[model samples]
Target: MPLSSEPKLISGNANRPLASAIARRMSMHRALNVELVDARVERFNDGEIFVEMFENVRGQDMFIIQPTSNPANDNLMELLIMTDALRRSSAQRITAVIPYFGYARQDRRAKARTPISAKLVANMLTEAGVERVLTMDLHAAQIQGFFDIPVDNLYASPVFALDIKHHFRGNIDDVMVVSPDVGGVARARELAKRINAPLAIVDKRREKAGEVAEMTVIGDVSGKSCIIVDDICDTAGTLCKAAETLINAGAAEVHAYITHGVLSGPAVERIENSVMKSLVITDSIEAPEPVANARNIRIVPTAPLFAQAIMSIWQGNSVSSLFDHETLSTIYDGFYSAS
Candidate 1:
């Protein structure tokens, strides 16, 4: 595709590798090959954060590739400051390409008095001069409504569907797509339809944060491989318990395809000890060594999808078309695999 203008790509401390991969994809496609803007984010002696963009972005299309992952507060602050800097520098358009949007879990107030941090973050980004937001698999789809700007919420279903098809060698009838809880049924059901598999739901009740009160498999998982689908897998308390519940209910094996592997606290240890066959995640957030090195965990790259989405936005094309099976298959064949 011929480009009218070259968009500058910027990276934060959250995930430099993903940013580099996205730039490479742009070059491979000959779409909008632009180098990452020279910028430095440093920390002071007292642990304050500072960001300085060296390259000129005046009247340019700028895309900032940063995931608000671990050390979410600091990384988010870096993005905000960078957006402010770009606005002051006269950038024509600023798109915040956040792969894994943090604070998305706090989208609603479950208690009597609590802050909707997701909306607050959206307001901060808008006020910081971000014109658009590109993110994937929000914890709650309603979070997209919180943003006033054009928000592109991408899906991991295409990627996972490709991987699952390869892993099962197009024979997915014996595989069951499972939702760990009621909230994730939509995502799980979509994957189930993609692979032509049966649907199952785990009726799990969480009495409190980080604690699952009860888990009951709602469908027949007997003698079938179960794949739990969810957006985030933080702490793994619910995931591990769900796996055990599935196995106890006669599932031949238990696995998962989660979008973001926020795997905090004892997540790695819990996965290692759980009965789960595997836990697949996308490179939306950087996985720590324990997860990368784990035998039961696999991470798929998401740069290609984001690269195409960014290119489409720059070209004024439709980003939703990329989700089509035929289109996704062509894209995945070039980059993704069972590895």
Candidate 2:
């Protein structure tokens, strides 16, 4: 499907490959008059950010592709500044397409003095001239309420389920989708339902703040191929530990499918040395060098899903089909084959 006019697509330094892939995907359609805006987003020696657009964006529907991932502060600043620049240039609409939203883990105040950073970021974007927001697998769904403007939060489960069905259809009878924590049960259940597999949850409890969490499986995983599904993989502490616990609990093999791989600190090393079969992550965040070279880590593209959603939003079409496994599976699989 194509729009009446070409939308302006611009990207910051956060994830150029994803942005370019999205542009490439949309341009494949003959009827889609698409244009990737020429822009430069850089920082000065004094640590000040600078944004300059080479093309005219007046009255154009602009979408900025920038994931606030690693170096979160810098990337987030770029998004804010770019939105401000687009608004100042008289663009018709500005949509912030953040594949991996930063500060999402701080959606609520767990402690007395803590700040709801997620809400603060939402307020910041709206104030900076972002009329719409499109992100994937938000840590907390309630974060959507923080924004006054329209926010389209996408799920990566469709892609993951499709991949699971395609690759493991032969042995899916023995597969079980596992949630890393009780909070993620709904997400896990959705994937399990899509694949017609059983669902399980991991009960994690920590004695102290700095102590490792004690994990216990809440369902039968004996002789089952367990796949842990979660939204983020920061530090990889809980994830590696959960994999070990599942293996000890008689799981046939342990694999992880996390949406955003904000693998920081010793995450790569811990995952490399863990007993898990493999760790799969989406290209929501720009992966670091170690993650790319890790023996057991794999990355799948989210570009096609994003491009599909962008086109739907711009065309005023229903995005509900994106959540259907039968419909999206075909679209998801076709993107890889054609890409």
Candidate 3:
């Protein structure tokens, strides 16, 4: 990697808390001194967005930490406009660090007369001057192909594995990793292999929209501590239902480790009223008040991981080098214990 001045960190309103956490993590890095860029994002009364950089970014590597979450359209537009500002200001390379990529579920045309919205978003990002994309646990793996630039799709498997280990501790041998549905089997299998636990799947049939038919456990989960693993948890209807099904199948305890916690609609209420012991999610999306007040919800910060990736990209090291389970375990040891 040729010298491009230094890494300049910036963010939009989408996820300032996560951006700040990442900045703090970068500051803690003994190798480099990183700080948030002094920038401004303003909106016109008519609902248009405007971004301005108060500080210099000429020939600098700009990393924008903005998760397209909640108000997806507004936050997404802010990112594209901010990237344009940095590009026009002569930034060497611009990377969009989108933790929760919205419209990911629309990667394909599920029905006729529909568009592949995920591909459209990818095209929009490339057109907006994004040289690279750093995101986590995309809804569909193939969405990476939609971009002309490089895309780093990080996984939460390492963090989840480390937490599962610490959670089970001495009772590790009696644990089972479960996928809430068939689609998540691979994710659950990866975590199961990490912790050397058996894999289980929850098979549920839906008779119609908004209704689930009878559910069954595919593998033996009875009398074992079961940990369900999934990438996203939105609404949490399926997740809460899966937890209850696990308990009904005679599992000793049920827990969930999900990457993106959209937690929209009545998710908080469902989780609070569900039979699961606890639900663990990464801070990929900013937590709202209702979720922040939930009793059984636990959050493990992804800032440390993102900080490490940013440092590696700046230093010309391999981004994939950070995926090792043992390495991530050591990186987040303190926060894991606290959470």
Q: How do the residues 89-169 of candidate 1 rate in per-residue lDDT, one tens digit apiece?
A: 999899999999999989899988899999999999999999999999988989989988899999999888888888877
lDDT (10s digit) by residue, model 2, range 1-339 = 333377779999999989988888788842564657888899999999999999999988899999998789999999999999999999988999999999998999898998999999999999999999999999999999999999899999988887787667679899999999999999999899988899989999989985665899999999999999999999999998999999999999999999999999999999999998899999999888999999999998888788888888887777767887666655566643211
* TM-scores, all models, native as reference: 0.96, 0.96, 0.97
Best by the TM-score measure: 3
Pairs that collide in candidate 1 are: none
Kindly list the per-residue Cα lDDT of model 3 for residues 227-285, writing each as its tens digit.
Answer: 98999999999998899899988999999999999999999999999998899999899
Worst 10 residues of 1 by lDDT: 330-339
> What is the alpha-carbon lDDT of model 1 when measured against the actual structure?
0.90
lDDT of predicted model 2: 0.89
Show pairs that collide, candidate 2. Answer: none
Q: Give the runs in model 3 whose Cα sits over 4 Å from its true position.
A: 336-339
For model 3 the local lDDT of residue 122 reads: 95
RMSD of each: 1.9, 2.1, 1.7
Error of 1 at 133 (Å): 0.2
Off by over 4 Å in 1: 1-4, 207-209, 336-339
TM-score of 3: 0.97
TM-score of 1: 0.96
